[model samples]
Target: MTSNKEDYLKVIYEENGLERPVSNKVICEKLGIAPSSVTEMLSKLQKQGFIEYEAYKGSKLTSIGGVICIKLLRSHRLWEVFLIRYLGYSWREAHEDAHLLEHVAPERMIDRLEAFLNFPETCPHGSIIPKNGELFENTQLVKMTDLKVGDIALLVRVEEDGDLLDYLERSGIIIGEYIKIKEKEEYEGSVEVLQKEKSIRISYKAACQIYVEKRR
Candidate 1:
């Protein structure tokens, strides 16, 4: 299986491929490719038993494809951890580099790296690192935009956008940090949040991409 196909499976798996089919439009958007290209790739994957696809419906990964996707995720997240903890790479840099490293890293090397990193639960961006043969479930995850005004929550997972990641890091929105939503500008569709005694305004689009944990 090519890494490009693995990448597609990974996205499908993340978007609940095990439970439901994902639209071709979603795949096209995630991959930043044209709809025609997505359709052609889906056809190839389906023929290989990696996925089930319908013309207008969507695509869902088969059991074999799901396993491959998990392995891909494990390698990617492990590399992200190594890059951040050992090489001093920032959150955004780690993800960008890990994307290439994950495809070439050996299984044994990843296993050793996992132990060396003390078996971290997540990557630098707070995304879960799936265990071998283990499925990850994030039922408690909530988008930053869903938080009510004055509500306090922990920044758990961040979408892997380099600019957004850098901006959040600069603004002190680090993972595990407690952020309180101070204001929700209905007209402007932006959110004002308080983090570490400083105030920051987040665009509604960005808020929808960030995930936060419920206050404990």
Candidate 2:
């Protein structure tokens, strides 16, 4: 598959397109492309049996498409681990470099890289790396937005967006950190959370992207 096709499939998978139809607008926004272009590509992917597309409703990946995407994700996350752990790349830098590397690296190379990295389970940003074309279940994780005021949770996986990673890093919201929701602004949906004895206020949109495990 071409790199463009792989990117579309990856975006669709990240948007949970397999479980539900992802709107063209969402895809367009994620890819920063025109609506017409998204429509054209979706049609082509559908014709190629990579996806199922419907006007107005949106598109979802087929089983074949999903398998390819999973493999790509595995490659992408493993590269992130290697870049960060060994090359001293920052979280955002690793993600950017991995995005470029995932398209061209052979599967065999990725397999060797994974082993060389000692079989990392998660990427620098805390996303689980798919293994053997299978995505591990993360049923216990909930979005940070789900927590109410005074609730404490353990930050786990974060959505792989470069800006989000940078902002989280600046705020000291790394994986495994404990977050206590100090306040929630009802009007704006923003929440103020305490992490490492520091208060950080994150927007609602950002909270939606961060995943956590609620503490008992």
Top TM-score hit: 1
Clashes of each: 0, 0
Candidate 1 segments whose C-alpha is farther than 4 A from its true place: none
lDDT (10s digit) by residue, model 2, range 24-129? 9999999999989989999999999999987778898899999999999899999999898889998889999999999999999999999999998888788888
What is the per-residue lDDT of model 1 for residues 19-56, given as tens digits with 9 covering 90 to 100?
89999989988899898988888899999999998667
TM-score of 1: 0.90
Query: In candidate 2, residue 33 scores what lDDT?
Result: 93
For candidate 2, the per-residue lDDT at 37 reads: 90
lDDT (C-alpha) at residue 214 in model 2: 97
Give me the runs in candidate 2 sitting further than 4 Å from their true place: 183-190, 196-205
